[model samples]
Target: MKTLYVQVDINSYNGKLYDFKTDIADLQKGDVVVVDTINGMLIGKVVGYTDDTKATKWVIDKVDTTAHKARLERDKQLAALRKKLEARRKAVDELTAFRHLASMDSEAAALLTQYEALIQ
Candidate 1:
């Protein structure tokens, strides 16, 4: 009847400590291990432990180097895609606004003109 608190190095959780059960006698803080999660197998680091005896049912395992590497690569690709999309959206917004600037009222046109100058 042992309870463990683990900090998983996953993107979504960002190294948050989740509850788990530890069977090994020597498990301690700062130990890197793999865990079975609802999402699949994930790598985690043991940050704390307790004898509260409430079983969380999560199992620790040996590191899955393949899954770890693949997850990192996927995160990198996703980040790049998000950056590109943000840039595209900004450019589209600027272009569309600039195109209609001439048809705006005096105050709106003046504000847009000042904004365009600042952005440039």
Candidate 2:
């Protein structure tokens, strides 16, 4: 895998470095590349390279309007899935805390069990 340093021009942030790795050879600095991000398909300019972080990189040469739109849609779907997962995780944590509290005190245990039944 070849490492490439990219500069992304975003509205809220300026000149943030997004390091990407690619199997496609001959990528040079200042080359406009399409990168898949959690936000969307970001148009990034290759600045340089780095020896930091190792992961599978998904890098594309160019992104047209159609591809960009598809990327955005996919990202939206992923965000929704992540939100649902986080909610489930929060519920599990709350239940675990309640169970721990119930184990500590007998008086509160009855009240906590009732509350848990209502939520479920």
Show pairs that collide, candidate 1.
Answer: none
Q: How far is candidate 1 from the true structure (C-alpha RMSD, Å)?
A: 10.0
lDDT of each: 0.68, 0.68
Candidate 1, lDDT over the whole model: 0.68
lDDT score, candidate 2: 0.68
The segments of candidate 2 whose C-alpha lies over 4 angstroms from its true place after superposition are: 1-63
lDDT tens digits, residue span 26-66, model 1:
66666667777788877677766755455455656644368
Judged by TM-score, which candidate is best?
Answer: 2
TM-score of 1: 0.40
Question: lDDT per residue, candidate 2, 18-62, as tens digits?
Answer: 666665566666666787677776677666556655534556664
